[model samples]
Each structure stands twice: as C-alpha cells, then as structure tokens.
Target: MPETAGPAEGTTAPAFTMPASGGRTVSSTDLAGKPYLLYFYPKADTPGCTKQACGIQEALPALGKTGLTVIGISPDPMKPIEKFAAKYNLTFPLASDEDHKVAEAYGVWVEKSMYGKTYMGMERSSFLVGADGKVAKVWRKVKPEAHAAQVLEAAKGL
Candidate 1:
C-alpha cells in the first residue's frame, strides 16, 4: 500500500471522484455546501464494518437534523456494496474504490498485520468535512461501536 498524506485541519479536502453503489458517481464537488462524513472501511459484510454501517444508519435521522450527510467508502466493488446496503437497509451512499485510488489519497489504505500475517488494506477511518470543504475532524483506526455517535457529536460542533 502507498503512504497517504492529507491537508491539515482547516485545509481544503483533496478532490476525488469515485464510483458509488447503485451506478452513480460521487465527487467532492457534489458535496459542496453541506457537511459530510466520509468513512473508509476494509470490506463489506464483515462484522465490524456491518456494525459501523448499521450504527450510522441508526443515527441518520439525528445526523440529518444536524445537517450532516454520511457516506461510506470501501475497497470492495460495487456489487458487494449494493448487497450490503440492501441487507442492512442503509440509506446513505456507499462508494466503491476498487482501485484504491481514493483510499490512498485519503491516507486510509495502509499495511496491516493480523494473526502474524501482513497485508495491505484499509485502516478503518472517518473524516468530517465541513461546509467550506475543509477537513474538520479525522478519526484514524476507528472502533466500530459508538462510532456514529462520536461522529454525530463532532458533526454537531461543525
């Protein structure tokens, strides 16, 4: 995996365009004028990822009231993402970064080790983009449980 770098807080978010589930394209520009939460995960249908996604889903109404839009991104292809969304009844958009370009750009893809095995994959993380397109908060190596609530708290401050 390639090393990732990003602008500091209060700096403009790097521009990106990726294929989203449901055959749509989502771009950084498309998120203008609204605060958005961009979360990166390793794969779809996994326990942690499912918990994180469902947590976000359950908090959608509260997040919406706070004027925040949530988007989940993963290295998985669109087919799995579509199935995951349907299975979880996820209302938010989920982007597929099969090429890992977006994940690399966001600095979420990295070398990971588990059970004494090493491999390259996404390091679950989340970023809060303010209305001005600047990164307001970044949660690296995020924990699944209470993540949505934590993000909601941060979004409230934005």
Candidate 2:
C-alpha cells in the first residue's frame, strides 16, 4: 500500500475546532471519550461531495446506533456549508475550515493538479477516531458512493 498523509492507525488523531453548520462548533475536545468520524472533502454542494454527504445522511440513524458521530469537514466557508446541509437535509455538523488549518493538521491538505494546472486542495479522506482517542482507521482518496457503508462496517466493531 502507498503511504498516505495524516495520522496512521493506532496514532492519536490531530486536534481541531471549527465552525460548522447549524450554528454549531466541533472540536477534538468535544469529541473526546467517544468514537467519531472526521471526513474531509474538497468542496460543498459539488457532485461527489453531495453523494458522500447524502450517503452518510441516509446512514445517520444506523451510524447513531453504532454510537459513531460523523462530522464532514471542507475548506469552504460556513455559508456554503450551511446551504449544503440545508439543501440535503444533513443534520450532522458540516464544518468549515476556511483557513484549512484543521485539514493541514489532519494531513488532508495537499497539492493537486487539474487541467495541467497545479493547485492546493483538500484530499478526500477520513479518520475514524476511536473512543480511546486514537485513530482506528484511515481512508484516503475515498470513493463517495461507498464511504458510508464502509464506515458503518468499521464502526460496528468499535
């Protein structure tokens, strides 16, 4: 397997605090003593991001049963984040990392190229932080359609 950025399994997840939709804020401290998922996406309201968010939304009740809290993080501002959540009826917190500090700490911020133009962007990645506060799993370059199911399977064991 190729090496990926961010905390590896068995390591402590990076700390973060940011504004989220629904007039909420999420932080590493707030999630302590509980298993949670921090999923990073490129943008809000985009096709792939939409699919991922919707899939997670559909699985929220099931995920809740597993006691796994899900938070979606993106580099977009809170405005777009709020709109996206409202439009999709996503109740879970969707955070805005406008400065990308959280994304950088998680190692999900990286360089990218599109149409032969190089730029920086958020990587489609996730970190599953177990109740003990260490990362139990890490998924890099995630496939939106399968993300929630994959997360659900892993969370069931936690």
Candidate 3:
C-alpha cells in the first residue's frame, strides 16, 4: 500500500461516524466546536493495544480537565471494543471501524509487515483536533506506554 498523507496542522479533520461501545454512535459532529483526540490502534485486546488503551484511561482525568474528549478507533467490531473497554474500565468512547473507513480517512489504515508477512492494519496514531475542527497535532507510530501523557502535554499547549 502506498503511504497516504494525513491532514496537516491547520487542516480540517476528516469527518466520520462509527459505532462505539455502549451502543453509541460517535460522530465528529458530536464533538463540534470542542477540542478532541481521535486515536487509532491495530486491534482490540492485543497486548500493545491494551497498554495503550489503559494508558489513555489512566490519563483521562487530566485530559478531561483540559476539556478534550478522547476517542479510540479500531477496525475491530463493536463486540470486541465493548469487551476491551469493560475489561480495562475505560471511560472514554471506543469506536468500531470495522470497515476501516474512518481509519482510512484519518490515514491510520496502512499496510504492515510483521515476521515477513505483510497485511493491512491500523497504525497506532493520535490526532488532536482543535475546537475549530482543524488538526492541532498528529502523532504517528506512537509508543503505547507513554503516549497518553505526551498527548496530554500537547493538549495543554493547545
């Protein structure tokens, strides 16, 4: 797969709506006029993804204090997302992008090579959308363990 360019800072974020855990349909419109974070991970319940999700959950209070709403998106269906959220006691929304449309729009869907086998997967990434709905920051190929703190620090600057 060719590398696709993502939205740059000051560019409008791509719009999307996906089925979230708790039977909610989360849409970019729902976050209208509010700054938010949209993160994409490869899969639900996997080790690295789990660590990433939990880190965001742990960082929620501080992030919330900054008035940023965080949402995690993955190609996994709603069932797995629900399980992942419940298992980790996550308070934020975990949206399902089973068809990968949202991930593609965000440029987080990409081809991957692991152990010499190539496949399509969601790249671990986060986008900070400002209150005006433009990109504020972009984190590509994120490290799962320390990502949330980094995002919070950036959000504070926003």
Candidate 4:
C-alpha cells in the first residue's frame, strides 16, 4: 500500500462510536470537548498489543491528571477485547472495531507484510485529540513499550 497519513494536527478528528469492553460504548460525541487518545493495534492479547495496553494503564493516573481519556481500538470483536482488558486489569475502554470502520477512518488500516506474505491489518498507530477535537499529535508505527510515556508527555499540552 502507498504511504498515507491520518488527520493532520489542527484538523478535526474523525468521529466514531464503537463497542467497548465492559459492555460499554465509546462515542466521540461523549468525548467531545475533552482530550482523548485513540490507539489502533493489530490484535488483542498479542505481545506488542499487550505491552502497549499495559503501558497506557500504567500511565493512567498521570493521564487522568491531564484529563485525557484513552481508547484502544482493534478489529477484533468485544470478546477478545474484554478478555485482554480483564487479564491485564485495564480499566480504560478497549473499543471493538470489528468492521474496521474506525481504523479506516483514522487511516490505521493498511497493507502489511510478514514472512513474505502480505495482508491488510491495523497499524500500530495513535492519535491524540485535543480538547477542541483537533488532532494534536500522531504516532505512526508506534513503539509499544514507550507509547504511554510519549503520549503522556504530549497529553500534558492538552
């Protein structure tokens, strides 16, 4: 796939609503006027995905101080998302993008290759939306382990 970018900084964030873990629904409308982090990952319960989720969980207190809500989006349905959150004790919303609508809207759904094979999947990417609902920062092909700290630093600006 050709290289592409998500919404640029200062552009309004694309709106979305997805089913989340804990039988909840996360909607951009409800998050309106508040900063939030929307992260897209390839799969739930995998090593990288797990690390990324836990890191955000670890940063929750500080993130909460910044008043930044976080939502993890994946193409997997709610079952695995619920399991992953429970296993890791993640209290944030892990939204299910089973139809890939939100991922595509955010430009995180893309072509991928592994072991000489190619497929379509969610990229490890994140977008921090400011309180005004504009994109504040974008991290593409994110490093799982350091993601939370990076986001926390940026969230302080929101």
**Best model number under lDDT:** 2
lDDT of 3 by residue, 1-158 (tens): 44546787789999998889888888999899999999999999999999999999999999999999999999998888999899889889999999998888888888899999999889998999999999999999999998999999999987
Record all residue pairs in model 2 with backbone atoms less than 3 Å apart, i.e. clashing: none
> lDDT of model 3 at residue 156?
99
- Itemize residue pairs with steric clashes in candidate 3: none
lDDT of each: 0.89, 0.94, 0.91, 0.93
RMSD each, Å: 1.8, 1.5, 1.1, 0.8
Kindly give the stretch of ten consecutive residues in candidate 1 with the minimal lDDT sum: 1-10
Q: What tens-digit string does per-residue lDDT give for candidate 2 at 1-158?
A: 12466788999998888999999999999999999999999999999999999999999999999999999999998998999999999999999999999888888899889999989999999999999999999999999999999999999999
Per-residue alpha-carbon lDDT of model 4 for 31-116, expressed as tens digits? 99999999999999999999999999999999999999999999998899999999999999999999998888888889899999
**TM-score winner, 3 or 4:** 4
Alpha-carbon runs more than 4 Å astray in model 4: none
Model 1 stretches with alpha carbons more than 4 Å out: 1-4
- What's model 2's lDDT at 74? 98
lDDT for residue 109 in candidate 1, whole number 0-100: 77
